[model samples]
Target: MENQEVLQQILKELQSVNQRLDKLEAGQGELKDNQANIENKLDSVVEQTVDLKEFKTETNNKLDTVVEKIGAIEAVTKENLYDIAKLKLIK
Candidate 1:
């Protein structure tokens, strides 16, 4: 009778161990899935950052070109005004 009780205890212990191993496997799978999701999100964020930087550079270049054009226009306007004033004085 004692031997039978020992056998039952051993069986119960093995069942508990199997349950623990199953839970561990499930937990590992969940972790793997979460890690993959995090990596995908990280990649998307990195791409967006790169795009923003490129856009900023392009906008800055366009603004610089516009400023240069405005300076040239202002210079021409000044020269024209001077020429007109000199002509008026002579007349």
Candidate 2:
């Protein structure tokens, strides 16, 4: 009778241990899912930052080109005015 009681007690302890292990596994799964979501959001933020930097560089290049063209037009206009002044003096 004593041996039978000991065996039954051991079986009950094993069942309790198994139940705790199941709860721990469920908690671990939730942590993994949360980590995956955070990684995805971080990737999106990095991509947007790269796109913004490229747009700023392109706009600056276009502005530099426009300034160069305006300088050239001013130089030509000054040369034309000097030629006209000489013609008036001869007449």
Highest lDDT model number: 1
lDDT of 1 by residue, 16-56 (tens): 99999999999999999999999999999999999999999
Q: Residue-pair clashes per candidate, as listed?
A: 0, 0
Predicted candidate 2 versus true structure: per-residue lDDT over 1-91, tens digit per residue: 9999999999899999999999999999999999999999999999999999999999999999999999999999999999999999999
The residue pairs that clash in candidate 1, if any, are: none
Task: Give each model a TM-score.
Answer: 0.84, 0.60
Error of 1 at 55 (Å): 1.1
Superposed on all Cα atoms, the candidates' RMSDs to the truth, in angstroms, are: 1.6, 3.8
Candidate 2: worst-modelled 10 consecutive residues by lDDT: 11-20
Could you tell me the TM-score of candidate 1?
A: 0.84
**lDDT for model 2:** 0.94
